[model samples]
Target: METTHSPIRPIPVHPGLPVIGNTLEYLRDPLAFFRRLQRDYGHERMVRINVGGRATTLMLKPEETKQVVQENNRNYGRGKSFAILKTFLGNGLLTSEGDLWRKQRRLAQPAFHRQKLAILAETMIEEAVAWADRLEKVADNKPVNFSTATTDVTLRIVTKTLFGSSLGDQLDSLSTALANLNHFAINAVVNPIRAPKWVPTPSKRNFERATTQVNNLIFGIIESRRKTGETRDDLLDMLLRATDEETGEGMSDEQLRDEMVTLFTAGHETTATSMAWTLYLLAQHPGILQRAKAEIRATLGERSQPSADDLRAMPYSSQVINESLRLYPPGWVMSRLSLGPDRFGDHAIAANEGVLLSPYVLHHDPASWPDPEHFDPERFAPELSKERHPYAYMPFGGGPRLCIGNQFALMEMQALLIVLLHRFELRPVPGLQVTAQPLISLRPRQAVQIYLS
Candidate 1:
């Protein structure tokens, strides 16, 4: 009963050329290529993929993923996994490692705890309602560019949650700056990691402009707060008051700015992408849509407005969000380098051997999910999820580095979906397919159009 699985031969490699493995193939159509691999080669394969001149094997199996994320977490750190994000996010929590990351994580932890989220839920609801109410005016068959709508809402939510009302008009420059910065980060990923930021390229110049814009805007906020000596009870207030529990020291204004920018990027973009996918899924499946509507109608009872309590009563709404993330995870692709020797199920992985995982692949594994490609929210039903492997459905990722903003995301998504469903029926426009565009988050390549009926 206790015998360890013996090491097996390395799984068959997918064909590739020298100096460049499956990079071109992957770049062409990653999701489709991944599907082709899964059909030809199951989860255990060691298919080599060239990632910007580096030959790294893509590890697709769920147990393989568990080894990297949970059992041997310390031996792995983000490494080059998020180099592309470095251009925009820098070394904030999403990409940093070792002592810096550990210290920052400790400092930022209190602002995202359960009690904090409960308090913030009111603000989340306020922002969701403000956006949803605007949609009530759109006529039937009029297409709504949901991607833009969610982006605006998530940005505003992050702003209000972080700064409260005091910094109201001050956020305009920050939002404009961030909009340009995200594109630069997306462009960086298309090129090699070694390219210097000061390359005189158009994207590089644009990146600097956006980065400078944010830096100037943040310094202004800090100066204003310092001069007035006023502390609003938002994320900014929490950071100001948060003394390091171990050392009793507080973060510098510069430090706070870095963390603020981090939250703004991580806190909003991923959630926007998640919202886009959730709306697309709702548009695709009207049966689930009606069930979701019934829950909202019954709980809220023909009220023109819905409260947080009404959102809580809709179980199927939460399940729909969960299922959407399952099928199309926001943090879809992740990689980590081994710091020391490790053994995964059957492979002996040496130190610095990079491990790759695509949540898109693991979430849709045939062995783990019935008709793996299908979108079924019931898969997240408590009873059903318990029977599945814990690692099989990781959209926010797994283990310690899992996104701290996950609860913030889920709550916002639930509230938004509840309000939208109760207000309008979204139907997909003809001939438009929702295609995944991988960036820091996975988004639909085309604008996910939903006609508000």
Candidate 2:
């Protein structure tokens, strides 16, 4: 592909303070700022803004977003946000680019294959059952913090499926450390300017401590697996046995650590957040909840546990989750950098400029989703979804770089819902209104308190 020599039209500039540009406004409230930009400037209208004195092009239309992520994806690479993430995630599948990413993605793809997912479905149901049992023991008409509960169960499931263990007593500490690391990463992305890692700023020092603890735990898991020559048919086993077809070499210990941490970080939070939001949505919408229960009950009959086949039969359950994701997608924003001067739609994107593809903005766009604020699972009904743009509802993102664990995430969500909804009716804790935090994943800013009656 050749870069056209034709002079490119200037993208409309969003006026900002000299030097700092849009950094402060964006840092204060990114979703609000982006939504304002989208409303003021119409869809497909490109605008130039600055982050840490760097020029970034904010794209609004799904078509332009498609070009950046799918059609001309090669011309764009994971941008600044991911660069900040590399400090923690290292050169794993999430942070690596080019051939390294290609090779890593290929080697890991088989582990998430359908057969593996089908096998994992039973484990998800088992975890959900255990979680419900714990909930039942404590349900005394008091408001339960659903957010904490879902995160706890999801983390357990990920540890069992990926590491082949529950991570023993370190589970609590590891969760805390990962949360600290994620907070630091999000702050770094928004604040832009920061002291170097060695400078010993309070945040930097804390980040270093968190990284050290997480790395030790992950490396310990790798060592234990290697020493035992474990073969549980889990992700760790798949990775340990994986050999590059061309190089005919297995992953190094460091490489294995990187991938494990990547999966731990990637797999756990997003899906957990998705489930938390789904519960909140169902609680808020009783009609939708009842309809979903009807499908679940009708599909499962007398069985308390849902099999892989039972999950497949509950399409409404999936639709309810889908609709919740549209309203509060965990992975709300996707970023890219133009590798060279490129054309997306009719606009010329200059080399090295940053591009943002915000699912929050696109998902809520009135043109694409009518009464976008409403909780309507029917929108996802097969016949209705066909009318929308392929990229219009991107919860897990799109293109070759789309989330590899998409099916795994969905299956896990379905299993949890089947077991949870069967046992409990989640009602809102009086007067509390759940709000989106819009961090690394769109988490509930407040504790989502629900009465499990």
Candidate 3:
């Protein structure tokens, strides 16, 4: 009998220049470059590529990606790319890991529970209704910038729902500061060779100013709440009361500030972008949009606003959101660093190697989703979704570290969609091209213009 040993070949790499490696190419167009890697080299398998001098492995298939994100999850940590986010987000649930992350997640879990989210649904609807009314007044022959409108509404909803009231006097300055910080952070991620903060570059200066403003605003809110010594049953109240089971101590002011900023930023940006893209897609496909509207009409006839119960009844609305997420996930790519030597099928993963899971690639794979480029909400229909792998769709991510605000975000989006579609039929501007620019979130490259009738 002949004994045969399976060859242990190195992971295939996509061609790129030395020194900077794939940094410049990736920055040029992330989605295309990643798609090329899958189309040319992936073979429905993991491939190693150079990213900013780091040997990064891209996991494109569902089973292998499940190994990284869900099965052998503990052996991975957040990647170096996330290090830049810590300056803005701090050690909140999104950035922190290990024991601290566990403690925080446990403490914050109850706040996003179904019952808790129901309490905030009315506020979400009120904000959506108010925004729709405002748009009705201003909308005319001119095309409205849907991106800006959606962001404004989501921001207002987040502020009111989380703080128990609007930002009031601090809204303008805080909004401007957050926008500047987002630009600076995305620029830092794309341009690996960046000057240190002390080097006094314009972007750096603006970032510092914005950081200070955001910190001041959050700290001021915490201080004001502390002075009042009253419980308002919002996120701030929940955070104030969250005590560690072992330590039995509440979060300090600094800790509160970190979590607040994390919630405020992550809370609104991703939800707004997702909703904006859904409307954009609906405009392109009138038949699907009409189906969605008909479902809403049947489920919630003559209701002024959708309650949480109404959201559950309107299944197509959820499908539309799910399909949009499949096409354009806000958190397009998730990065994790390996903790130890490991093997997935034939490939060997070394200690401390960066691993990435791109939901965009997996969702678009022709093998998994037939006619992957086609816009079909029916892919997520309840009966059809039963046969798909659990890991195949993770707009809110998977495993223990899944986003805590998942339920909250879904409810907000569903309510907003119901209110907006009821009031206006969005028509895309003629000859206008809207492209997805992959940043911290996948946002429109420019303003998405739509005529609200």
The Cα local distance difference test for each model comes to: 0.79, 0.86, 0.86
CA deviation > 4 Å runs, candidate 1 = 1-8, 43-46, 166-170, 193-198
The sequence of per-residue lDDT tens digits that candidate 1 reaches over residues 1-453 is: 897778565646777767677778877877888777766777454465665667566667777788788877888977574776765676677877888777778888898887787777788878777887777665445899988988888888888888776356667778878878877766656655446645687767777888998888876777777788797758877877777888888777777887888888878888888898899988999899889898888888858767766667778889999999988898778878879987655666677777778888887788888898688989888899889888888888888888777887898888778878888887888888978877657888999888997
lDDT of 2 by residue, 1-453 (tens): 985565566788888999999888988888888888888775546677786788888888788878888989899999878988999889998889999888888788888999888888888888999999999998887988878888888999998898777878899889888889988998987666677766878888888899999999988888988998868857889998988887887888888888988888878888888898998888888999989988888887898888887888888999998998999988888789889988754568778888988889888888899998899999999999999998888998898888888898999998899898999887877788988888888989999888998
TM-score comparison, 1 vs 3, better candidate: 3
TM-score of 1: 0.93
Off by over 4 Å in 3: 1-7
Candidate 2 achieves a global lDDT of: 0.86
lDDT of 3 by residue, 38-110 (tens): 8886673988888888889999888888888778989999988788888888898889999888888877887
Per-candidate TM-scores read 0.93, 0.95, 0.96
| Candidate 2, superposed: residue stretches over 4 Å from native | 1-8
lDDT of 2 at 400: 84
Evaluation by lDDT, superior candidate among 1 and 3 = 3
Candidate 1's error at 263, in angstroms?
A: 1.2
Q: Which candidate is the best by TM-score?
A: 3
Highest lDDT against the true fold, candidate: 3
